[model samples]
Target: MTTIKASCPSCGDVELTPHQVRLVVCSVKSWSYYAFICTTCHEEVRKPAGRDVVALLISGGVVAEPWNVPAEVLEEHEGPTLNYDDVLDFALWLEQADLLAAAAAAQGPRPRAQAPETAA
Candidate 1:
C-alpha cells in the first residue's frame, strides 16, 4: 500500500504503487534502471537507477529484477567496423565452403599448403 511519487515529462508529479514500478539491477551497474508508466500521461518513463536509488526503491517494497549481461558483450575491440558488403562477401563464401570438412580439419593439425614456385 506504499505510494511512490514519480514525475512525468508532461505532467509534473504523479503517484505510483510498488507494483506499478519495475526495477532492474544489471550486472553492469551503470545499466541498472527503473521504469514505470506515468499515471497522468500514461506514457512509460524509464530512468537510470544508481545504488542509492536502487536501495531506496527496494526499501519502498519494489522488487528488484536481476539482469546478467555477458562479459564478451562488454569487451572492447579495435578494428574497422564491418559493413553490409563485408557481411555479404562472408555469406557468399560460406555458401560455397565445406563446413563439415572445415570442422573435421579443425579437430587435427593439417599440413600447410605449399606456395607455388614463382619465376625470378
Candidate 2:
C-alpha cells in the first residue's frame, strides 16, 4: 500500500497518513460517495474542496476537481490539487483572487433596495 505523511493542521501533529477513501452518508440525502480522508485523523480532506470549489479554481488548486471532472475533457486540461506546500501557494493565490473579485464586484453590480414612500 502506498503511504504519504502529512501534518495534522487541526492538532499540530505529524501523524496524518496518505489519502484514504471514506464513504459519507448525510441524514438528509441518501447519495453516498467516497472521499479522501486523512488516515490518522480521519477528517475529510475533501472538505475544503467541497466548501469552495470556485475559490479553489481561482487559486489554481482545484485538487478534487480532476477526479470529479468529466473524462472527455481530462485530456485537454487537468486540475491538480494542492499538496502541503501547494496549500501555502493556494493561500497567496486566493488572497489575490479575492481582491480581484472584490474589485470587480465593487465596480460592477450594486443592489438597490428602497422602502415604500411613507405619506407625510
Candidate 3:
C-alpha cells in the first residue's frame, strides 16, 4: 500500500492511503480538485488539483473522478437580475393569462378574402 502525504489547515501534515484520497478532474480545468479527511482533526480538507498534481496522484494509484459541468451554467448574461417580487408577479400573471388566446391574438387577424368581381 502506498502512503500519500497531505496537509491539513488545523493538523499540519497527515498520511493517507490511495483509497483515502478523492481526486476529481472536472471538465472545466480550474474546477479540478482533491479532497481528504485529516487524520488528527478528523476534518475534511479540499484543495485545487492542477495538472501536475492530478498526474502525480493518479500515478500513485488514486482514482480520478470526472466532473462534467454544463456550459450553460458558466455562461455570462447581460440583463437586470430578477428579484423575488418579479418571480411572484410572473407567477400571478401566469395563473390568469389565457396562453392559447394570447398566442392566437399575436398572429393578428387573417386577411379578408376579396369578393369575386361582377362580370360586365
Off by over 4 Å in 3: 91-120
lDDT of each candidate versus the true structure: 0.93, 0.47, 0.95
- Candidate 1 residue pairs in clash (backbone atoms < 3 Å): none
- Point to the candidate with the largest lDDT: 3
At residue 37, give the lDDT of candidate 2. Answer: 53
Using TM-score as the measure, name the better of candidate 2 and candidate 3: 3
Q: What is candidate 2's local distance difference test score?
A: 0.47
Task: Write model 3 residue lDDT over 1-120, tens digit each, in one string.
Answer: 899999999979899999999999999989999999888888899999999999999999999999999989899999999999999999988866878678889999999999999999
Q: In what order do the candidates fall by lDDT, top score first?
A: 3, 1, 2
Worst 10 residues of 1 by lDDT: 95-104
Candidate 1 lDDT over 1-120, as tens digits, reads: 889998877888889999999999999999999999998888999999999999999999999999999999999999999999999999988876878667888899868999999999
CA RMSD of all predictions: 8.2, 18.0, 5.9
